[model samples]
Target chain A: MSTPDPRLSINQGTLKYADLATALRATAEAGVQAIGLWREPVQEVGLATAARMLTDSGLRFSTHCRSGFFTMPEGPARRASIEDNRVAIEEAATLAAAGAAGSTAVLVIVAGGLPQGSRDLIGARERVRDAIGELAPDAAAAGVTLSIEPLHPMYASDRCVVSTLGQALDIAADFDPAVVGVTVDTFHIWWDPDVLASIERAGREGRIATYQVCDWKTPLPADVLLGRHYPGDGVIDFGPMTRAVMASGYDRDIEVELFNEDIWATAPLEAVRRTAAGFEVAVSPYLTE
Target chain B: MSTPDPRLSINQGTLKYADLATALRATAEAGVQAIGLWREPVQEVGLATAARMLTDSGLRFSTHCRSGFFTMPEGPARRASIEDNRVAIEEAATLAAAGAAGSTAVLVIVAGGLPQGSRDLIGARERVRDAIGELAPDAAAAGVTLSIEPLHPMYASDRCVVSTLGQALDIAADFDPAVVGVTVDTFHIWWDPDVLASIERAGREGRIATYQVCDWKTPLPADVLLGRHYPGDGVIDFGPMTRAVMASGYDRDIEVELFNEDIWATAPLEAVRRTAAGFEVAVSPYLTE
Candidate 1:
């Protein structure tokens, strides 16, 4: 009997230690068809060279890691975030320009957390929406889809005020689907009871830009950011979530994004292999089911 | 200018060190109108003695700590949870019978998290609903309202499957309001964007059983359970939540329940004073607004 394909892609953060070259090479060797790039590594590898590397390897750049810390207080901080996002949009365009024909390279945006010492989440969210809306035209022209990834509510106060898929869609709804959409990352959203319905709505609305997979684990790391686990290792049943997004007509690549300190400590290649296995166990069954 | 009233009712858990007698005496001396009792402390002091203490001090047993761990595997575990709930209902009955005229004693149910090694939140939630439904007859007969507390999603795995007021109300909708209702704890529900609306709906449906206040502090303790802070020490804006519950026509005593290590380490009497002050600063303004 043949083994099932995990249909996996690696988000660079899953192997935080790997350089762009090593990560790109590992993606091909790991037998995955795509890789999600973080701006820091992409820039370190030099954007032009990184884009060419992805093109040369015939690997899809599933998404440009991020660009949407638009929640900072107004003035230089806010202006800087918008300007940086513009550059990210341009980078996303270059990466998507070389992907598999119709694949839309997505720029996953983690709307910045609350400004230091500011507890005004409502105001922060409004600022994020305005910032994203302001960038939509540039995103449309560049052919890069801006995907709003709502962080978990635990991060609502200091990381991202957008804590729900419904909230992400609310902001995305105000822009063109070609320019703005929502990313569904299981680790961040699985706890949401309404997530399934939200994914369905995003699908029907043609706003499902990307689907990132990871499991939610407990005794969250002190950093909290390093707490994400590979699929099947935690309480989250990725089957329901994966199947829901799939049923929503999301046929695009699914990236197994882990931020665990343990996972990152391993060799990037070995981590990719384990991620593939985890994905097969946790998510592949649902694909067939 | 006079100091604002805390309108506080300390949950015995807030002072986990305090015995029932100490808790009762401190609550009365703290100038608060009520106290929420945990079963262990009540049983330790003997139910009859605890009831007499509450009566003697003119303190209302705003609620009985809990009864709902129905998610355990079937057989002894499940039966034990139901049986325990029955005893708690009886205890709640005894406590409520001694309350000041017009006060309805509540049984705050922290629906247990997922059963050992299980990951089915939906199933666990259903089991909770069924378990609560089974106890409704006893609750009705005893005149103790069963409050289904929707804990924060962070606790959905091991503490409570009901993670939102909407979910709690959904389960409660299947039962009698006089028997089953929902708890709105600021620490648990503050992260929910739609909590205000859910509170209003709970009020309209007459399912608002109790209101518990505490602030949500981050860098959660190793044991996330101890992460709660006194109001105003954290990011939760209690004014909107307090006013929403108030506007819902809920006139029952509000209980300030903290399960923080720092709070527990304080002298019970001193903790009461601090909790009172925190409530006045974080919640009193909303009462007037």
Candidate 2:
């Protein structure tokens, strides 16, 4: 068995605007251990076709990009969102069944901002919890572990309402450990004061399912939706973060996911290769034997 | 006594590069109840001169812009930073003595980010705590309650390492309640999952000293070194935040502090007046009689 570096996984978002086949080929060629596939790319090539390519290229599957949006106001829209996430879970299971290494774990959630005409953040959070509770069963039956990805608090309004690791674990603790888990992204949770403690708790509880890496830039623009730096380029100190994750006993893939205009503007192959190199350099100190 | 609208106050940053006296005069003319002053302006015109003008215009002093840099890594720089903050506390005391209405508090805290080659965030936080511990005595003696302003998590690196209300309060809890308190700026703490709970706790403990407001925009530009947006123009759900602060028993002035380049580029007076108006409209619902 080849002992590859688990810290070098590719998140499809790094090459989001690029063609799926082209992106996958580039990722495989770059020697990344795994890739986090998104729904859009799978839809583009058809799931079976994409599965065949991954099979051919020997690319391992990291957690899928997402599967949660259960916070919409009660109505058809909410039901539709839940159904869509179910489909994502099913897709993850399909990939697992098709010989991708590791369990079929779906990066289960992103926060949806406050509903129209609503001024209650607590109510919004309750809605998120209720929505996830509703989806946990279907996810479990499909042999998929729902990994709640707590986004940066900056996205608390429009994106994931799950803004901290502690909050995510609280939600996960409500469900069976095998059904619900937490995915720790360095960019999102690095600023959290209780992150290290929370990670330790999650690890002890066996809730950590995946790990992601990205950088936080300084003088961040007032608009954060599109602002993200490549790992090691920004201010987030990942040394302690890596040590904390490793301490969590989570020997999972560390996916590199950046959302910067500058990196996105470059050629897809070059971006993937550059990201792999950056990842190696950024996390080299924390890499365990 | 003319009862000023407590909800409408101006933070000097909204004016960007405008002259402080000019901005203050315009804010008073615009009928704003109070203004949050910065050190540069107070230094430029001399605190005594600035105080005299506020006395002449009958403008309320809501809070001083800042007085903390307690997070500097060991050495003369850290000591020098704390000394500078002490001067700011003295400046706030000067403003209070100059006939400005209400409790005058100076924001005291630390500079965040990797100090030189230090990659340990937890260690940085400890340094910040120690710095605060060191400054509390001087602040209390000056009759200036150093308000610890918890900046947004995005600023966890280079700005203020204190990124949440809970974290700020935790540090404050270690000091004499009369000496250290917490400042709640909507721009900074709105994204926190536990914001409401933390605010409530602050109120229960009488730690809620200063409050400010602004909005968060998505797709934010990479360069935020300039300024952000006015209260109502961005994506943040200010209504919930306003209610949360009010519910926390914070009956103090709610200052409007926007770091927006667009607003700053305009005449300083114009920016203050416009922001004051925006504050009235955006936060009117939560204002108590």
Candidate 3:
């Protein structure tokens, strides 16, 4: 029998349209052994029911799909966001608990964009740092790592102030490596000139929690959120980047996280198949084993 | 009478609605002593006519809009882009010849994005470097500097591959600083985490050829090209950035470059007035007389 590709994992966002049960079944039936789950879909499936289904499917969890919009204005809004992240950390712990032994349990933190009517990106970034510091203890207690994912500069205004791996690492450096790390998403950081060096530094520091892959395409959709193409379908040269991640000692599952309307519109099974096929071409060659 | 702001210049792009003569007239009348000319409008008005008009209007030429889409496929396509840039250099020289003397006549080079059917950004960037090497002599002979402008990463796929000031500097370092330099456009690089250091490096290296300012706004227009807001109308903190450019030993015109449908739709004179107002509020404080 052919060896199973242990590193291949699909983020639920690639199958965003499917219900939790259907997507999990499609993933396992396709021989993909792990997934990165989004919070909303898990909530829709009910956390307990989602956890039970994940346990039954025998697939592992890599990282939880994010919760950190801490750039909210002072008072109730900011407090609520911090409180929400605490719950996300708990949910991540639960999700990881149902997975096989040694599987990663990470809560990805996407630093929110500027608060309404505020042009203070530096201020926003500081708040993200404060929020992460506030949550690191909960993350450590829950046995889940908090991975800060730096979105591309394009998303800096409305999505994430953390626009480079360097910035994410700077923020991550303040916390314990076991509790705070950084997620490297190719779609978000392919254009950064400093990324390769940052990746090397991330590896040496033992802080690379998760490595996500998705190609970058152009004439982006009106929403821009739907702009990611599947691996090998766009402009990113993934072989070198993925190899860099592997060299960084990141032996965990390489999650294929995509957010695109066209890919999501495909039948769930086909999406999984396509993702696997893309992984083989764009990502598999970098595997050491 | 109050002293005229020598550093403030109007890039013709901010007056997308005006004819070249009207724009020049409006700019000089508004007490702006310098202008950055776009090639299309210059061609439309006739290059010689445009040069004479500038001299007559007494407005010095800061920079020529752009002329470097060198990422085209090889043979005639690539050669044609090189030839076009040569022409652009000559035109820039003519614009400078008409100036009051000692004014910089710079040609902006926007590194073209991914070649059609090709996703090799590294390859595209190398081609840009090679194209600059080939053109440096012509630019030097014409006494016009070739200024590489690294567009924002959002434009990395369809517009330009030179996505960071550091990358542009790496390319510029290979050629003579007198002939090859880099343009610092705030709108294109405001999100860069390394910008402050990059600006200092450019100053130390003597490559700060032109400094352009425009504000960054979100929910970009359907056509992202038309999404730039006037400075201070959007979220950029320009004071520190402008100060960084000046401290870089860059004593050149600060061109206010904007690309937006709404701004373009405004009356030509009002657009210039608003640009001047924005410069005074967001940028003037940092300029040392």
Q: Number of clashes in every candidate structure?
A: 1, 13, 0
| Preferred candidate (DockQ higher): 1 or 3 | 3
* Docking quality level of the chain pair in candidate 1: acceptable
**lDDT tens digits, residues B1-289, model 2?**
2223555778787775867778788788777767878889878999889889878878778788776756667889887887887788889888877746674665644446657655577888888888777877888888888888888776777777888899989989998777888888787877677887888888888887887787766545556544367777765667766777787777777787776667777776667666766666677756753
Candidate number with greatest TM-score:
1
User: Which residues of candidate 3, in runs, are more than 4 Å off?
Assistant: A1-5, B1-6, B72-74
Ranking by TM-score: 1, 3, 2
Question: Which digits, one per residue and each the tens of the lDDT, describe model 3 over residues A135-188?
Answer: 998999999999999998988999999999999999999889999999999999
Better of 2 and 3 by TM-score: 3
Best of the candidates, lDDT: 3
Backbone clash pairs for candidate 1 read: A113-A159
Q: What is the alpha-carbon lDDT of model 3 when measured against the actual structure?
A: 0.87
| Predicted candidate 2 versus true structure: per-residue lDDT over A1-289, tens digit per residue | 1223555788888886887788778887766667888888888898898778777767778777777766768899998988898888888877666535653465546757766545556778888888778888988898788898888876776677788999989888899888888888888888788988998888888888888888876656545765677777776777777888888777767888878777788888788878876776687568673
Which candidate gets the maximum DockQ versus the true structure?
3
Per-candidate TM-scores read 0.96, 0.90, 0.95
